[model samples]
Target: MEDLNEVYLSPLPDSPYVKPFRFNYTQNGKKKTWDLLEIHDSVAIIVFNITRRVMIFVKQFRPAVYYNCISRQDRESNNIDTKKYPASLGVSLEVCAGIIDKNMPVEQIAKEEVLEECGYDVKVTDLQKVLAYRSGVGVEGAVQYMFYCEVTDDMKTEQGGGVDDEIIEVVEKTIPEIEEMLQSQSILPSPPSMVYALMWFIHHKADKFRKTFERTCVECKVK
Candidate 1:
C-alpha cells in the first residue's frame, strides 16, 4: 500500500470505464511515449462453501468480452444482429469481484464484494489474500488484488446480486465440476482470477477440501 493520491482528468470518448492518456518520459536518453488506459485497481474473491463442499461463482454478461469475441464481419453483418446476441455470448462464470472505488481498505472492499456478489457474511480477517497483480500491462497497468475465503451455512445473510444497477447470477459448483470447467475454457470463458483462484486452492488446500467433500458425501449418503 503506497500513498493514495492521483487525479484522473482525461477520459475516452463516450466510454465511462476507460480513461486514455499519454505518458511521456526519457527512456535511456531518448524520450519515450506510451498511450495507456487508466483503469481502477480492484479486488477478487474466491468464495468456498466448506459446509456444502462447493465453490461459489457468479454468472454475468460483460459487454467488452462480447465485443472482443465478435468478428469484424459479424459486427457488420445484417443477417444476425450483434447487439441481439451479446447476452448469450458475453455471459461468463467468474469469481466474486469489485473495483476499489471507495476510500476503504482493500480487505473491506473484498468483504463487501463477497457479501454483495456471493451472499455471504464474512469478516475482513477471514479473507486471505491470494495475489496482487497488474491486470493489463500492454495498454495500462491496474493493480488487482485477489483473495480467498471460506463460508459456512450460518453466513447466508442475503441473496447476492450486487449493490445496484447490476444483475449477477449466483452460481455454485462442486470441486469436480470446477475441475471440468477449468479445462473447458471455450464453452465457459473464465477470467484469470477465477482460474488462478482454483489453481491456488488445488496447490494449497485441495487435500483439506477433498476430505471435506468426502465427509459431506458420506453425510448425504447416510440421509
Candidate 2:
C-alpha cells in the first residue's frame, strides 16, 4: 500500500472543516483518478476501571444515527414508547476519545480526553496500539489511532474538566453490561471500531485485566 503514491491533478476545494481535492495517480501500472480529502489525525482511548469489569463510556448525541430507528412493528412488539422516540440519534455510549491537537503527543491526547470525557485522571501507561484506520472514508479522511489504558478508583473520583460546551456524560458499565449492550444493539450506533476494540480487550486481556485491577487498588491505598 505504501508503494502507491498519488499525484494531485487540480487544486483542492476549500471548506470550513476540510479541503477536498482531485488527484491523478497510477497503481500497479494502471492510471487511476482519486479524490483526496484532507483531515486531522485523532486518538481514542479504551479506558478500563480499577475493577477491570467496567469501562468508562460517554453518552452524547450523534448526527450520524438520526435515521437508525427500529421499524414501527418492531418497536411496538418490543414495547418501546413511541412518544419517546429519539428526535435524532440518541446519546451514543463510546470509549473516551478526542482529536490529536497540534503539538500534543498521542498519549497526552488520550490522557486528556479520558479526563475531559470521563472525569477521570488516567495515567497513559501500558499504551498498546489497538488499531488505526480512516473513520469516514467517503466524506472525510480522519485517521484515528486507538489505544488501551487502565484507570484507578482515585482517578474515577477526580473531577474531570471536560471540554467547554460539549455535553459529555460519563457512564461506567461492567463486562456483563457491555455484552448485553452489544447483544441488544444499544451501544454506540456507529463507529464499529469501538465495538471491535472492546471485543479485543475482553478476548486478549483477561489476565492482564486482573493484574491491573489489583495494582490500581494498591496504588489507591498508598495514595
Candidate 3:
C-alpha cells in the first residue's frame, strides 16, 4: 500500500474536468470580454458529531485560498516563496466537500464526501440541503450546494484522510471553541465556505443541536 511515482503535468492541459475560456457579452450595450473558469458544481457538508457534541471538519492545504490571504505588506516583508513552504502555507478547516462531476444526485455526492473526507458513513436521505450559491462569480460561475448532517461515533468506519492522493486531516471542536474561533481575527486564515456553512448551521440547526447535546449517550459519555 504505497503511492506510485508522481508524474507532474501542466495543470489546465492535464485536467479535462476544468477549462478556461473567454467570451464577449453585452454589458450596458457595450461588448465586454470576460475570462472564466468552467468547473463542475460542488457540494459542502457541515457535519455535526451529535454524540461528541462537536463539529466535524477536515483540514487540507488549499493553495488558492492561501495565496489570496497573503496581504501585500506580509508578502513584501516576509519574502514569501511558494516552493519553499507549500503544505504549511494554507491549511483549510473545512467540512467535507467535492465537485459534482458524476451523474449522481447532489445529495448522494454529499454523502460520499462525508465518507471519503470525514470517515462518516451516512445515508443520503439524512443529508439536509441548506443552500445553493454561485462561487467565484467574478472569475468563474461554479455553483455549490451546502448540506448538513448529524453523525455519531458509531458512524465512523475508518480513519478517513481522503482517497488516493488527497491528504486530509479530520478535526473536531466543541461549540464554545467554534464560537470563539468564529469571532476571532483569524478568519483570513480560515475557509469562507466553512465559515458560511457554520453560520447557517447555527442559524438553522442550533435548536436540534442543543437537544442532542443534552441527551447523553453511553458511547460519548456526555454525562
Candidate 1 per-residue C-alpha lDDT over 1-223 given as tens digits, one digit per residue, 9 for 90 to 100: 1111221123247666778889899988999999988788999998999998898998887766665666776655544453445456777888899899899999999999999988899999999888999876889789999998999979999999887878888988887787776677554467766778888877787667775435555545642
The runs of at least 3 residues in candidate 3 whose Cα sits more than 4 Å from the true structure, single-residue gaps closed, are: 1-14, 66-86, 207-223
- Score residue 72 of candidate 2 by CA lDDT: 46
Worst 10 residues of 1 by lDDT: 1-10
Residue 13: error of model 2 in Å?
11
Tens digits of lDDT, candidate 2, 1-223: 1111121124335665566778789999999888777677898888788654578777766534532554545433434443545444455667778877668778888777887888877666756778888877775778899988777777675555367767766778776666666676545454677787778777876445444444455645741
Off by over 4 Å in 1: 1-16, 76-86, 185-188, 211-223
TM-score of each model, in listed order: 0.82, 0.68, 0.80
**Total clashing pairs for each candidate:** 0, 0, 0
TM-score order of candidates, top first: 1, 3, 2
lDDT of the candidates, in the order given: 0.79, 0.67, 0.78
- Report the C-alpha displacement of residue 88, candidate 3, in angstroms: 1.7
Error of 3 at 203 (Å): 2.5
lDDT sort, best first:
1, 3, 2
